[model samples]
Target: MKNFKNKVAAITGAGSGMGRELAIQLAEQGCHLALSDVNESGLAETVRIVKNRNNSVIITNQKLDVADRSAVFQWASQAAKDHGKVNLIFNNAGIAFGSTIEGFEEKDFKRVIDINFWGVVHGTQAFLPYLKTSGEGHVINTSSVFGIIAVPGTSAYNASKFAVRGFTETLRQELDVMKCGVSATSVHPGGIQTAIAKSSQINESLKSLGLDPSHAKDKMAAQFITTPKKAASMILKGVRKNSRRVLIGPDAGFADLMQRIFPGAYQVLVGKLLLRRMR
Candidate 1:
């Protein structure tokens, strides 16, 4: 919102990466923070950093697993009660499952879907009431460049991010129909340096599949990815502008264009080479 000063903002996955950075940026702008993550230490660290900024706002940190629907709903209710109202909800917690369909494990598959897809569902649905109560609010859901275009070896991740994009788009339309001031925006970040590349669950079958998670991380990190803080600032700009779809990174904007204008060309170009690289 234009008047971020003194407004309350709630974020999921606020322990590290872009989520934590978003909390800091919003706090710097005078927004009160309600930060949640499964990592209690990380959440506390985020709160500590935000408080150190001399923000004239209260910061709350909670250990939350966004995939737990009941917990998300309960905490959302509590957050609204404690903060008075929430003007922004960043449903941004996500995981990466770097597996080809053939090499993917069921456990990792479910974890990716639960955290990346259902987590957004839980966060959006849980916070909507509070968002509505605030009269006007914004929802920022992290999809990925993969959400729009699927390359090889990341089916599970693509599915979850694609679901988030579609879900957030539908909510945006619904908000319009219902004439609610609350709006939803989907995020397509190219490759911000996040732990998902390495810390992500990659099954042991990768060696058999001739894939290396370590190589994946190294290749990704070499992309000279935008910092989490930069991504967070871009996200805040998107929220302020009420963007329908915010694409981050220099590569992401190009990818989005190619996706819309040259989907079939983009497919053939990235696919065969990408599949070969995977193996």
Candidate 2:
């Protein structure tokens, strides 16, 4: 846990953004990587970059949808078989959705939950055995600042992230109770620079809440003050320390503090700030 050298790490969403940066950094530190992403081109690019930078690092990649339980399990098996043993699983694949609860479509809500929440579950369950066999392992699940504080027009995203937070925390506790060498950390990241905004499902429902869906994505992207490389570095640091929760940016730290101070009252401040942004 204190070092990554010779460790085998499986990372989902490794095509770009934080995932790609994590792979690159881990490779630089002498870690072997098993990478996957739904974006085939992006995945290839990540592999290319890792190879170009660290030719000695072993890597295997797959075009994967983390929500697919069988596929994730299969990939886990393959990664362990190929790498000899697996030591880390970064369950980082996620998607964003923006809509009010009243305007949210069931299918869209399900999609966000499936990929953002269930995907983490699948990755953990699939790779857990391999991690246990390795005798030193870590599970990193990506949540968000929204998981700590809710705001308008992001009900689905908030739900999914919140679920991830709860699930990962519980998993971490169970791992501790079992005295397993494996550990888990819930990652609450602020707006780190990533492609999530461009690929988010921002529906017209935001209009019903006096928000403009057309400009929402751009507005969200503008708040991304942290870079993916920095986020990746912080995450790895957390893993080395075996932190129970990791907050990536200043915004994330502020959100966590606000929730601790205001709890139920923070909703009003969040609503006002979001409305001001939309206007």
Which prediction has the highest TM-score against the true structure? Answer: 2
Task: List runs of model 2 lying over 4 Å from the truth.
Answer: none
| TM of each candidate vs. truth | 0.94, 0.99
Clashing pairs in 2: none
User: Model 2: how large is the Cα RMSD against the reference?
Assistant: 0.8
Q: Which stretches of candidate 1 lie over 4 Å from their true place?
A: 204-210, 272-279
lDDT digits (tens) for residues 1-279 of candidate 1: 666888899999999999999998888888898899999998888888888995578887778999899999988988998998998899989887677688776887998899999999999999998898888888889999989888766789999999999999999999979877898899999989887676666655556545676676555455647889889889888888889999999878877888889878999877765556555
Each candidate's number of clashing pairs is: 0, 0
What C-alpha lDDT do the candidate models reach, one value each? 0.85, 0.94
Worst 10-residue stretch by lDDT in candidate 1?
A: 201-210
